[model samples]
Target chain A: MKQSITLGSVTRFIGLAGFLETIKNVFTGKLDKEDFKNIFRKVIMPLASVLLFFAVWYLSANKLHEIEADHLINKALVEQGPAEAEKLRACIASGDKSCQPNALPSPVQVWGAYQTLLADHYVISADKKAFKKKTASLNAKRIANGEKPITYTGRPSFVDQIFTSIITVFAGFLLALFIAVPIGIVIGLSHTLRSSVNWLIQIFKPVSPVVWFLLVFMIVKTFTKNSSSDSAFIICFISVGLCSMWATLVNTAMGVSSVDKDYINVAKVLKLGPMQKVFKVILPSSLPLIFTGLRITLSVAWMVLIAIELLAQSPGLGLFVWEEFQNGANDSNSKIIAAMFVIGLIGFMLDRIMLTIQKMVSFNKND
Target chain B: MSYLELKNIYKTYGEGDNTTEVLYNINLTIEEGEFVAIVGFTGSGKTTLVNLINGLLEPTKGEVLFKGEPIVGTSHERGVIFQNYSLLPWLTVGQNVYMAVKEAFPKKSKSELNTIVSEYVAMVNLSHAINKRPKELSGGMRQRVAVARALAMKPEMIIMDEPLGALDALTRVNLQDEILNIWGKEKRTALLITNDVDEGIYMADRIIPLRPGPNATLGPEFKIDIERPRDKTEMNDNPNFKKTRNAIIEYLMEIGNERKSEVQKEYILPDLAPKSFVW
Candidate 1:
């Protein structure tokens, strides 16, 4: 059975074949049919606009190069003579050795940076394998001598940095769920507890990620004072998780409280135990809103994790961006820009994943 | 002692200027295995009265008693079937029934519980859609699931809050027969709250009218002396059925007209001028 493209809908996003086929059809003049108009509007039109943006960006980047070259030319003319100025002018005209060293890199430069990072990752992975083998033999010899075997500690690669960021955000989100959901339920069930927790929620809801990161680091540092890898990881994820937990907590409480009164009455009529009432009726009815809150919480966790990782110098994508900026090399700016797009794409994917899970559990879907 | 009783029940809401009385000095009783129906207008506080009896709401002036003990809270001994929005929409019809059965009979074996759930689902003639969720079924079907869920618990008494009120007329008559058939077999004490006079007369052993509120009270009880397995078509031919229905409807109409007069009357001064018509 064939799965037809449901144009102008989610299929345009999820069906890669449909997206590619539409573009191909347009080029081949086969997309003039009325059947493909929705595909054109929903899919091809967005692509056109994106291409237009790239064109504008490419042109502006070229203009920025000329502007900088002119500045340098004037400076050289004043300091030296026309001879050196002319040489710089020629390089500028040739589109080489121009633009401010720290100017924003164009898409092409960012693409190049992405390839370079990929190559760098491969090289580091090979190095890690070799290091592991060398350490294994050394550890074997040390074990034979009955001494403590040395462990190899190495820097994470670019790919490893991305994984680190993902894991940290997820860990924080899980922690937030663990802490917030039960509390939300309690607050939802009891008027007194709700009033008591309301103030705390209001006060802490808007506390900045940096502040949370600092507070978490201080607390975790005290606990894992002599620790290394595990401590930093725990600190990073916990800080982000706690900082982002307010959304899910508030939404969960609201969801629980606002579950249809009829359902609650049914629960009461059934004489369901407190636990049974919550799990059987309240939770199922509130699942849609709770999942909505969870989705928001997850996104918040992901957004805050980068900043937390950056502040704590935890080995994640945010740290990668910071380190690249500090490196101040020829391709450093481009590498940072590349990381920005990668961060954005990952955040989008995380939301989509959460949305899928939300749809699975929810009976009354909003979308 | 009566199986269920409400003594001098006066339910009020709010305080001071906001205080509004709903039910006033309502005393009622239901004997074991007796089927009773309370008929009322839309705002007659019938639901509030049902809630009081079910122990969901407390009466300001009095209390309810079940089996000689004052009702403190909701209990599995009294199962309730609401008109709508009763079953968990996420759960299948079978699962909805299973949930209640499991709660009421915690010691039942897994297989035995499954059997009880299916039996009730089949009893409601919804065996074909047992696996379907509440949202997938029509209004009548969902109500059937509610009925099945309530009956599966095997509660000593069943409280039905207009269980057939939302269904179509035909569906209502069909369900009325089904309920009667079920009640004939088990003889559980049932309290049905409905506005439909025919429905109340057809389903219950006694029909009671709740006068319209701000302080609604049970007006009069009409004992239905018709035999079991009463046919809806044959009910038109029965002289007792016609006489009883007319009496109930006539009582309801009197109360309805009384409530209408109770509303603030608009005044219009008669204009005493005859204008000359232009020829």
Candidate 2:
């Protein structure tokens, strides 16, 4: 298949060459009919091969999909009750089946469920006074129907939870950045500091996020009696943030300290002020390394965030995944899979954000 | 009084049992606006001497006096052109020169400083590549930028530590002429450290050779009485230029031979393996 693609590319190049020649001849008042035939011969056969390669892929993709589908079907049968499982198997094998074996609740069903969830919470209720009156009437209606009274979770709304998680992550990252970069610079610049801190950094750098969680949990328990609030979220965030900060701190310090001594001499000879020396000379020279550190730190922070959420039951994508995992249902696997996809997408976006920032500050454009 | 004076300067590296002498009893003086070249074999402590004069390194004994006052640490007053063309790689040629100009005249407006930097860049005939970084420049062009940077500072004395040593022969001659032209216009006190005898004779008012070391000191001084605005081809034809070059070369060769034997003697060892106990 790859070979056919290469052949196809060669044909495309031949076609381009022929087109260029025809244009050249038209401008120069000269044309060769034989050249056109030769170009066609060179281009057409390869183009046919490329088409043939894609045809093979088109044929094979369905076969691969069937194998995957069969695997999923077998797994689903093991989990289902005998009557429903037999029905699903019969539906799948019948070939005229209207229902897709792999389909979770249809898009329409999920959308309907989402609307019901939102309406139950009175999310679009007119105002606080109106919402209170509407809630009271709804409660009465539910009681008359002999339905259970809805209890408030005492946590934020879903949207508010998202906002809280974002704000916490941003604040935690900023706090980590504030502590790490300067410490890295000091470690990088001074031999004594580097040696003294090396053992400590090495020990802490590879420690798992769970250790940070337990340690932070203890500290928070001792320091603040207020759990089941934003303080819990902050505490969880700090745990992940500190765990993620070590790599960047060490990398930054090494970067700064390892800047060429010649540059230091230039700074000294220029008689730059201490602030100017650090900001202009030292920082600019170490930017590539510093950015690299930042990139590693951000990715690690994202991974640690998930671990923190899972362990602490903090509200975020991590908690969403944990909640889905705990609530087993016919659609739970799909939800877990969907949540994993979102986590990966968010991590990718974070990396891209760091890359954009790196591009903005980098003095070397060629890099 | 000489513009710059080194009175019985002594430098030793390490201490106690491990102590090793690098430079010993070095005494020299340069008159105002005079270009003095110190020629030596490699490892004869020529760089150490330049470093001391520039106050990059302090001498173990004796004082380096600029005018009548004792020399302190590195300052803007003493500009150094290092052999490596120590222009920052990240900055363009114009920016590198502007950095020094900016430091020397912190109160100047941006446009004013830019104009000054451009003038120096033009002086080196590198105006076309003013915005090019050091990595983009040829070896010769980079060194020219280094020279312009030092000269633009308007220091009282310029200390060049083999500034053109890394360039090709043709480039070296071209940069040498450029350096001489700048020195002629400014008439700043200049000290050049080089190993090339002809270069020393061509560019300096006086050439002094540093004797080969464990403990190297200044050898005899040869004064180049040749006239200024020296054309390399024309200078080669002059009898006095030939005489001065030959004299400096002979002194360097004599010191080289002494160093050769010293190394040979130091390395020759006696075979002693406890006499292989024959019991």
Which parts of model 1 have CA positions greater than 4 angstroms off?
A: A1-37, A95-101, A143-155, A228-231, B264-279
Q: lDDT, candidate 1, residue B70?
A: 95
Candidate 1 docks with a DockQ of 0.60
Candidate 1 — which pairs collide?
A: none
lDDT scores in order: 0.87, 0.79
Worst 10 residues of 2 chain A by lDDT: A101-110
Taken in order, the candidates have interface RMSDs of: 2.0, 2.1
List, residue by residue over B40-149, the lDDT tens digit for candidate 2.
88888888898898877899999999988898878899999998887877778998999899999999999999999999999999999998888788999999999999
Listed per prediction, chain B TM-scores read 0.94, 0.93
lDDT of 1 by residue, B1-279 (tens): 878888999999999999999999999999999999999998889889988888888899986989999998788888888867478889899998998899899999999999999999999999999988887889999998899998999989999998888889889888888888999999899999999998888889999999988999998799999997788889889999999999999988888888778675777879889889999
Pick out the ten consecutive residues of candidate 2 chain B with the lowest summed lDDT.
B266-275
lDDT string for model 1 (A283-355, tens) is: 8888888889999999999998888888888889989999988888878988998999999999988988888
Fnat of candidate 1 is 0.79
| Native-to-model Cα distance after best TM-score fit, residue B52 in candidate 2, in Å | 0.8
